[model samples]
Target chain A: MKNFYKVGLMLTVSALLAGCGNLTNSSLSSHSNGTKTSKVTTTGTSKSGQYSTLLQGGEYHTSAITGLNSESDSDNASNPKSFEAGLLEISKKEFSPDKYFFQEGKMISASQAQKWLGRKSKNNPEGLNPEDNGSTDADKRNPIYLQQLLEQDFYTQNDKNYDLSGMTIGLSMNDVDYYTKEKYGAKFETKISDEQRLSEGREMANEIVNRLRRRSNLKNITITVGLYKQNVNDSLVGGTFFNYGVSSPGQKKVTNWKNISQQNQVLPVVNDEKPINSNDSEDFSNFKNHIQSYFSNLSGVTAQTHYQDGKLKGMAINITTQFYGVAQIDSFTQFVQDAAGKYLPQQPTIEIKIQTVQDPEAILVKDYNTKQYSSHVFASY
Target chain B: MKNFYKVGLMLTVSALLAGCGNLTNSSLSSHSNGTKTSKVTTTGTSKSGQYSTLLQGGEYHTSAITGLNSESDSDNASNPKSFEAGLLEISKKEFSPDKYFFQEGKMISASQAQKWLGRKSKNNPEGLNPEDNGSTDADKRNPIYLQQLLEQDFYTQNDKNYDLSGMTIGLSMNDVDYYTKEKYGAKFETKISDEQRLSEGREMANEIVNRLRRRSNLKNITITVGLYKQNVNDSLVGGTFFNYGVSSPGQKKVTNWKNISQQNQVLPVVNDEKPINSNDSEDFSNFKNHIQSYFSNLSGVTAQTHYQDGKLKGMAINITTQFYGVAQIDSFTQFVQDAAGKYLPQQPTIEIKIQTVQDPEAILVKDYNTKQYSSHVFASY
Candidate 1:
């Protein structure tokens, strides 16, 4: 019995290790146009039968003021007439690049990045300098920084026309490679497929566009949904993680923006032996369920449109219902089916980005050794 | 302008009822105990003080038992022993009665009283003798059957070692007059104060002795505390109230022993309007304090003891200290000069009594008109 128990334990551990290995090699990619296409197979049972009839064929329109502009101009353009007839018509059906990547002048400060990553450097290391100058290097590719930059750009560019009232949205699980390196002092191999990345990105972009179309200015708004994938190496640690795109309303001028400044960046220690695949599927499922539940429970969400760049993606048939003394969306499952039934045969995709991070101080060194850090990081931006 | 308006209104009223007088009187007595007691005193700068030290005496030993008969015949009779010792030595020290009246087992059914108070020649006009017939009168007095008898006996008993264990107590403001009228009718007014003619015989004897000694087992024990003054018809109604005494462990036998029939007697309800000129300096001080604040914050308490022959009386101090924290009392203004400064003046006290209730149904009639109820009634007793 003892030997059998030991063998069973061993098998479980081996399975977990295999899952982690798969995650390391996984490759996911997103198109520059915001479309996500993937070829990975899902392990879970499909509920595609529910998506029999989906909405399709919608045109996307762009606002006259799509680049970086002051709040006053954005407000003027967002007036009822422009918002309903012009700005809304354009931004409503399409996903804009300026809405997902950082604009030139809106990058976070080095101190802010350090606080998020839980580390400190000597000086601001911006541009090509990589001698721990306390600023981020423009050439360096930091996936975590890129994720934050995307979030900021998305909010600034789409906020005026989207009417994304009363929602909490943000990018999460960014800079996994950097965090892993700093905390674990060990490198991880990516296993996500490129096909999966593209699909996930498209799905996310479509969801965001749909959400923007149903906008109302009566509540707080948040919209976060996308995926990306990349590799981590010493040379890419100091480079800019997020590339600035077209600026939009409530944004600073591109001329006054710093060049890929490492203003806000922090290196957190990563745990070397901490297994990440123990419950990956379960974790993802839970995350998806949480998002669906949140949307389903919201009040006054009448309609939604999905898109990728300038292309119209899908639309959701929002049904309001009262339950437990509050107004709520009946079900996101129903919405997804009504919005993207034809798109279900293809596997929805998500991208995973990885990067190496160097920590000058041993601030989180003890935490890494103790295996106290959680694998999935949740970023507000 | 005011004269013209008044003249117009007057002419209208005169046209409606020219012959009706404005003055009128209702049949109801506004001086009922409940109504008069609810009135708030508007006097300014009334001298306020609390009851003095609660002497440890009377039935203290019997009450130490947590449950009914739990400590029966136990070798560790520490409680009973301490109570006896305290009562014996109370006179040497400066100690105040826990309250003024002893209400133990004064409850008696009208049927039970028929043999003692009802004359053989007396005939019920409606041929409904409550004693012989199964009537609601017996049921009405069910809750008070034991308390009234005890109070009457406790006041009349003179024995210092009166063993009043195994008796219950109750209280009622209307019992005395009810029983008196039922027995004597019109002659009640003339024979009420006569020691021989009064229903409480030996009990009154014992109580009178205790009152003379200024140490009553009746202290701090009453289910209800009421204030009354003689009206034009020489009937009881609400007025300046004072605290009543209750039976305690040391004075139980003396107050409620059934073998001593005279032990069931009640003290007269003293009216505050009547002048009190006691030779003792403390009497005047007590009267002043009692009139101002004693009744304002009276506490409620319940005590259990052995009842014998349906009579019980005793006193127990219910001390509850309010402190901002565990270390300090909230309102300790002056330290007691005596007893190594261990005591404080103006401490809260609650007098409870178990007296024979005349209208048992009346006990259920709470003064719902006021948000606060009389705190003097011993709820659980």
Candidate 2:
């Protein structure tokens, strides 16, 4: 009872101190007392006049947390570590305790994915060595390699951690993409997804997190995984949330995970093992030949087709006229669509490069192709 | 020992069955075997060819972990949830055992943050009556309110529980933004940041998450807090990781926490309160008037100033003359720079919106403004 009184007294004193501070704040609030105040935003049921209009046209300044990760300085004693990076660092360091709980045995396996995402060799599909064979450094920057480590390998926070019963292991799939024309010095005419893309993304993360729980060495360290469909435009468009720790999560999850990796971008060189015009296949060369023979020669128009994995997917057609009209565009699209229907038999669905064009960027045509059947979307980026 | 042998024998048989699947996969691998394949992507140091391509622009779909969180089919077979409204209905329906970890206090005291995010004559800056005052349903969508409940507000995951210790609580701040001249049917000529905007964003999320850990009710429930700088063009860009358990583990550390709430678009409200112009003070209205009198008057050049805290920070001057030489542009910029120096006293530093106009988006002249020193920037958005 005596201890309670003492604690209650301290609380009273603190409340009084806080009251003094509030008084100062109230005085500051007077700064807005003389303005032509009208609520700027409304709430669900009532008009909230709580927000005072500070600016209307010219630039307005608002308080923000800056250099949040800047090293802590003791010189400014008024600024507490609890306010800056220290707080984040602390929360990040030990957010998950020595032991946690999660469902077991539910995640996607790269070994299974190795059948496609990894090595072409079936035995090495999951890429037995995720370490980039050519790179001398560890595969820290390799998403696939790091994901392999995250899925197949486990680390425990406790040193003497041998018993691994009743603990939950987490699995995550982090994949990212990036685009920078300025860095590339050339326009890479690539396309991406819409809303459905994001919905599917969470599902992928769910798979990894679910599976990691089943692994044997799961302890202490909490794992988070996801994917990034990152792209670099006039500004960096994707890839956010970075925690300052001893590790680079980006090096693990999604860092340039979406790049059409230079190796994969190369035209397959004809080899002794695989003849170009073999019985069961039609390759890029054949597609290009077909495009040249079928479409480019159509009406004094030159066309370029962008494809991957030996199928015709994207094309840029020059219709001879720069300031083209809707009718001309339709006729052009119709012509191309007809050609695709005939020559590009493998790609049942196709679309034009809406951006790889000059301005006036008029949608002169109603995109006759849309009125027709939709083409299958191929690029996951 | 006999049971172990039986189980081991069953596992061995299953392993062989899996191998048969691999044998079939190897036959499919022959497809790439026919092509000259080389990995395209490089590791940090040297380029590597670790990837294998399967999509031939047609539909060569690879398998992925699906049916994750899917409901069990048999109604009486221990699991009878058949995939909810597409969301995973928790299997641990009431997972935690009884009164779990959490103090009695520490949630948003309806009295404290009744204003908006906090109190201001009874409105929470984050908004009060988060019950969606207009709607009478549960708060499954309101992340902030849910976070508050997860933090201070206590509820039993399952009844028959009374133990509260050694648990940590977490907070999340999920803010997103969008950019779609294509979707909104109109283009709001709002200028945002190149990098600093991203820096401030993480800080906001950090603040929320950090504060949550300090709350009394912070235990057990792990909160993953974050913000997103989202834009909708061809793809969805932000806000990914989410987990519901004990302890908040925010991911992607800080991505985009503030991009202006989409809800605020509803009103162009002007508020009423003591117009704190202080009779002789520099206030929001004065700044607006100053901008109107100064930059809006410049002939042949339409200018816009983006400010924060009522201080002008950015001015985008669009001159009709393009492909026009730099010298003439310098004269134009000088005229405006001089006006800014004289009129917008609060804003010492200003920048060019490098993307607002056509080519020669390049800085035509060294900003006389830069030689003149700079000021703090304030765009809370």
Best by lDDT: 2
lDDT of 1 by residue, B1-381 (tens): 111100011010100111111212122222222312111100011011111110112110112111111101112122222222222122112122232111112233333333322222246322111233322242333111111111111121112112112122211111222222253343222112223212233333333334423433233322211111111123221111111222344442234322211111111224443322122123223322321231122232121111113322221212222211100110111000110011111221212121222100001001212211121111100
Please count the clashing residue pairs in each candidate, in the order shown: 164, 85
What is residue B366's positional error in candidate 2, in angstroms?
Answer: 9.1
- Please provide, for model 1 over A17-74, each residue's C-alpha lDDT reduced to its tens digit, 9 standing for 90 to 100: 1112221223334222232222211111011111011000110112122222111111
In candidate 2, stretches whose alpha carbon ends up further than 4 angstroms from where it belongs are A1-381, B1-327, B334-348, B353-381
Off by over 4 Å in 1: A1-381, B1-191, B195-329, B333-381
lDDT by residue for model 2 (B1-381), tens: 111100011010101111021111111111222333321110010001111111111111111211111110111110111111001111112223232211212343333323323211233344321232332122222212211111222223122222122222222222221112344343222233434334443444455445545554343344433222222222211111122222233321323232322110001112442322232123323433433342342223333333333433333333333322221222223333333333333332333221113322212111323434111110000
Native-referenced Cα lDDT, model 2: 0.24
Worst 10 residues of 1 chain B by lDDT: B5-14
